[model samples]
Target chain A: MKFFINKENLLFAIQSVQRAVSQKSPLPILTGIKFSCEEDKLVLSATDFEISVRCAVPATVEESGSLVIPARYITEFARRLPDSIIEFEAGPDSTMAVIRYGDSEFNINGYDASEFPSFVIPEEEFSFKLDADLFKEIIKQVTFAVSTEESRPVFTGVFFEIVAGRLTIVATDTFRLALRHTAINEETPELINVIVPGKTLNELARTADPKSIVEVIIGKTHAAFITGEIQIIARLIPGKFPSYRQVIPNQFISEIKIPLKDFLESAERVALLAGENNLLVSLYIRENHVVLNMRSETGWIREEIKSEVNGDKLEISFNVRYLCDVLRSINYEQLVVRFTGPLTPALIIPEDNKDYLSILVPARLSRE
Target chain B: MKFFINKENLLFAIQSVQRAVSQKSPLPILTGIKFSCEEDKLVLSATDFEISVRCAVPATVEESGSLVIPARYITEFARRLPDSIIEFEAGPDSTMAVIRYGDSEFNINGYDASEFPSFVIPEEEFSFKLDADLFKEIIKQVTFAVSTEESRPVFTGVFFEIVAGRLTIVATDTFRLALRHTAINEETPELINVIVPGKTLNELARTADPKSIVEVIIGKTHAAFITGEIQIIARLIPGKFPSYRQVIPNQFISEIKIPLKDFLESAERVALLAGENNLLVSLYIRENHVVLNMRSETGWIREEIKSEVNGDKLEISFNVRYLCDVLRSINYEQLVVRFTGPLTPALIIPEDNKDYLSILVPARLSRE
Candidate 1:
């Protein structure tokens, strides 16, 4: 293979695909990124069994061929090259590749391209296009609530459910749940339910550009997203997601509207005095004020903030970290909090929009 | 104790002293900062046995007393407080401290002030005032070469030697040495030698302001530096530092001058192609040009840069990381490299000044 490309373009393509490359894999070929040169473009691909990334860049190709090179070494070399045109050529023995930029040349050892695994995408699947910015925002809003513990594999992913014209993404780790809903332009009669790993969604969110348009294709066992010159394919987690609708409380005995910034600041302060391991925080709501109390073996802290309270006064306890995560994820000025009882789950929503909701389970109170 | 102070001023003072506090110390008092409230000033002190920092801020004192509060918690609390005057008072039993800023209040459990270790700065045996920027520059130029290994405790510190009107600082780890010298105004009859820990010096360098003068007081066992409202005292590392002057070659058989930026960039590129471990780079100096070579199991990289080489042509090999460190530390336009032989240490100095020098020991050739 022989091709010439700009340094910055080649570096960006390599980095986009490098996220899926595995450093240590049972299959040695997985550590190499397959490079293919065609008539007018060069494509780079890397996969680690669960996810794969492929990127194509415009290039001047003198010969069409394929070669697989070590991912880390080539990436580092390409990144350090001067901002000039880089030329890559495969040797006749197919055991070495030469990279030349400016007056420098790098002879990198290559692995057999035939040993690389072939990844295929289904031709017929549920496909739709969405704004990259919205998709990335949805992932960021819900992915943080996914469970890191692998004991419950289904809970380690975000649940994506689409019905009619509205699409909702939800993630829950039992302690807290984040749900974001948006209306799509496409009309689909089929009900789509799939659990995508939180980690893969996070990577997509980071790589996707904010103002770009992205096309998403979902199949029986895998999902793919195409953004600009990059295509990302991730294996879907095969399991039945729990029914979260039943857990969301429909009615509340008390509701309060508080400034989001003020509440977040007060919670962070009280968290400093919370328990080291449990990080428990107690909320005492009375009339038009809410008091946050935290106690640890070392000390205790109490902070109060004024709010617009309605219904009966009540008290609830929760993990301070869980609440902080929800507050940080929501970019809203005012938030409405609804409480059912002392032990029931509390729901928080943005005052201007009801499409997003955060649910938190109350901590068991310790008798003193 | 009772006092009120500006939140910003108190936060700055607390942050400066908190640098000396470590949470993993065996002595519990080391994790707390002593707060002494006098008639017009509030002094905060924290120590980790080896180093201590104390800073004072002006405050309105209703009563005079002292207490020790947990460092981490207090710092975090003060940083997040509202932008207003903060009021602090000790409880009647002297076991708890109350802090109030704006509408927020934090009550923290306190330790007895008597339990805190006393950091005493005796009448200075040798006192001198120096330009903070110049002192900071000297520290930055040489401190990176200090040994990180704990086997040789003395090598982990920088040797600060003062003779007549010259101040010299040297750091080495056997394989490489970085030396920087400057002229002071005072001419002392007695020579002074002290080894200060690299960690402490780095912290001092960061905290010192570049626009002001810093008063340095050296005692028999400690070195105290007062910059603005902050004072730092660190115990000296008592041991014999190696005589690095003997290792520097006095007579050079070959010399080469190269642009610093070009040399550093080329070295970085060559380093990327070196092996993951045991990276050795070879430099071949000819009559009119220099070539950098690195060959590893994975690949090989060769880069040539034109330079004005004098004397006999020579080839030498050294660890790439060492050369990169020295090249990065020097902020000069051109650097002159001197060498006696292939095995002798190579000296690198600024083309315009003789006050700084970096020496690198050659690596043994592999028998493969």
Candidate 2:
């Protein structure tokens, strides 16, 4: 099989599909990215059972066929190939591929494409479409809270559901939880709930352009996200996601509205004295200011930031990293933090935006 | 001890001296940075036995004294402190340092200053001065060829020698060598030869400003580099340095000039197919162009680059990384390479510069 393609387009397609290729996969075929040239298009694909991605780029095809080449070699070759159209051809045995650009040529080994596993979107799956930017942003807001541990597989994914009429996504690692939803303007008659692995959402958000609309399809055990000419199909995380709403506090004794920038900088400075590996920082709320106190065996640092306060004064301690993550993800100038007590979970929200909410558990630091 | 110092100046001093603080030193005192506060200046210092750095920043001392504080905490506090002057004070036991900036304060633990070991400059040492930029540049050109293995301590250092009144520096891993020297115009009445460890030169280059002339003092076992208010004294590597000039060919049978940019780009691309650990690439020199051929069990890549050839067609193989290193380190448009058959070493030199020269030993490819 022979085809000539633009160097930039080929590299883009190879990188997009190679994201799903597992470099350390036990199966040799899983390390290969399948390349198929048909008529006027070249389709590149890779899968590791958990997730599969396929991207098709326009190319001139004098002879059309398919082969599976090592993902690492193909990416490196495309990266180093001269800035020009490249003549790529595969031998009849589908074991060797040659790439020529300018006067440079690379002959790389590959495997027969017949043995490669491919994912197919279920015909009976339910389908819905959302603006790519909206989907990517929502994923970014919630995915950071997902558990990275594999033992608790359900918490390792972001829970997706149709709550009321809006599409909602929620993630939690037991200690902290994040929930973000699209505008309630869109109506959905059918109730849909699926837990997608956080990795799949991150990969999709990283590759897909935020301008276009993305079509999403869900089945019993798999989900597919389609954007433009690229499609990503991932296995739905098994097991039931926890009911996080119950854990989030419904009432708060005190609410303080602080400038996000001021609070973020003060928190960062104070957290430096909280020791390595530990990010414990205390928040003391008063009438006109909130004090951040962090200490370890080596030192203690306290910083105060002015804010608008309501209700009784309270004090709470939390992992400073969690608060920093929430503050950095949102672009709001002001943030409202509500505290029920020193031990209970605190709720943080953007003052101008109501769609995003984060709950952080208080840490227990010994005063002794 | 108590003092008030500019936060930026103190931070710079701490950062510069902290490089010599050993994070994994068996002796706990070596991990601490010694701070001596006089009437008008505060001296901060750290040492790892192999190398020591002392830097002084202007400070107003309310009480004159000295103490040793943990390097990590001091650097961190200084980094996060406000931009204004910082009020610093040590407790009566000289074991705790307190720093206050604006409304924020940090209390850090430390050790007694009397117990900390500090290096004293020898009065009998000989001193010399050299342009910092020229010395830093010469170190950069030759240090990359130094052997990193501690087994051969001398090979892991760049030999500084006075050859025919010129300051010559040489380094080699035995397989290859790089020698760089200043113009042979400056006359040195006293002959000096010393070997400085690669790490010491690297740290000095990284921290020392290249604009000033550096004062270098050579003692029996230590060499001190004094630039501005910062001084770095390192234990010189002691052993016989191999005569590298003998290995460098004085005469060549053939010479070829190639565009550095073109040759560098082609070498990097072809080296991609040279396997993970081995970066050997063969250069086939003909009348008009040099073809780079690199191969592994999985694949092979051949790239051709045009050059002005004065030699007959010859084929030689060498580690492409060595060639790339020389090409990237020097900002030369054209480089002249002299080859004596395939087995002997090849000399690479910048067309317009006589200050740098690098030699590469040919690799024995299996096809031999």
Which model scores highest in DockQ?
A: 1
Error of 2 at B126 (Å): 5.6
**Poorest 10 consecutive residues of model 1 chain A by lDDT?**
A118-127
lDDT of 2 by residue, B1-368 (tens): 99999988898899889989989988887889999989799999999988998999899999988888888777876786667888989976778888787766777888898887777764434566788887777788888898989998999998988755678889999778888877545556777788989999988877778798888787878888999999888898998899877788977767888999888888877766766666788889889888999888888888888888885688899988887777766667999999988888999999988888999898877676
Cα lDDT of model 1 by residue, A7-54, tens digit:
988988899899999889988778989998898999999999788999
Candidate 2 ranges with C-alpha deviation above 4 Å: A119-134, A184-186, A210-215, A274-280, B5-7, B39-42, B58-61, B82-85, B119-133, B163-165, B184-186, B210-215, B276-279
* lDDT for position B46 in model 2: 94
lDDT tens digits, residue span B133-156, model 1? 887888888987899999898999
Q: Which stretches of candidate 1 lie over 4 Å from their true place?
A: B273-277
